[model samples]
Target: MKSDMSDTNNHGKEISDDAFATLIRNQFQLESLGERLQKIENETATMKDKWRRGDEAMRDFTVITITPTEFTLGTE
Candidate 1:
């Protein structure tokens, strides 16, 4: 059996079974790659949002000293 696609490659060329199968497989692979890329982008965005919220929460954080022992801590 042959697959007939009109107006392809500037001519109505009849595609053989093997060529048609390859074309279909390639299209499926491209679609799968696109889906994977979209998933990765979504995951990256979610990670960025989590990081932003974490940073904001840290910004409003406060530490209280329970014991009144003072030791000089210096950073060089």
Candidate 2:
């Protein structure tokens, strides 16, 4: 009877340790996701600004395409 009671106590302790480890792992995963989202947002904003500048510059550019051989560029 004493040996059986010790076995039960060991099993309970193992189960409790496993639960704690699982909880920590879940928290780490959540933090990683938050960091990735922030990076994506920053990159998106930078790209948007670059696109706007390129569009503005193109509007001020002049087309001077030469026939089949060469070309020149000027701002108008």
Candidate 3:
């Protein structure tokens, strides 16, 4: 009877161990995903900064058109 009880307790412990392993695995996966997201966020900010600077530079550009009879200057 004592051996049977010990066997039962071991079975429960095995289930608990499996659950703990799964939890650890999930935590690692979540951490990896978080790191990837952070990298992407940084890259996006850099791209946004570049785009803003390019837009500002374009804002100062002027276009001129000259024909035989007319000349036109335009800012865009």
Candidate 4:
């Protein structure tokens, strides 16, 4: 129901040929960005699935719980 972006062009008044061309170009740009965002979302979902599987495996084993701030990873 709510609009995400606002359209600036006036529908009643006559628009110049150059303005029409600009509008078409902007619409294509938005389409390209939408495609890119969808691709990223798919990749992120894949990564999350992998992490969830790994966490489940780790939970089946015994682990030594420690303080968050006190545990320094990759450092002896």
TM per candidate: 0.71, 0.56, 0.60, 0.59
lDDT of 3 at 54: 89
Q: Kindly indicate the candidate among 3 and 4 with the higher lDDT.
A: 4
In candidate 2, what are the lDDT values of residues 1-76, reduced to their tens digit? 1122234435534445555566568879999999999999999999999999998777656333344345435633
How does residue 44 of candidate 4 score in lDDT?
Answer: 100
Q: Rank order by lDDT, top first?
A: 1, 4, 3, 2
Q: Which candidate number has the best TM-score?
A: 1
Off by over 4 Å in 2: 1-15, 62-76
What digit string (tens of lDDT, one per residue) describes model 3 on residues 17-41?
5556675689799999999999999
Q: Candidate 2 or 3, higher lDDT?
A: 3
Q: Stretches of candidate 1 above 4 Å error?
A: 7-11, 62-76
For this target, which candidate reaches the highest lDDT against the unseen true structure? 1
> Better model by TM-score, 1 or 2?
1
lDDT of each residue in 31-63, candidate 1, tens digit only? 999999999999999999999999877765623
Model 2 residue pairs with clashes: none
lDDT for each candidate structure = 0.78, 0.66, 0.67, 0.74
The lDDT of model 4 is: 0.74
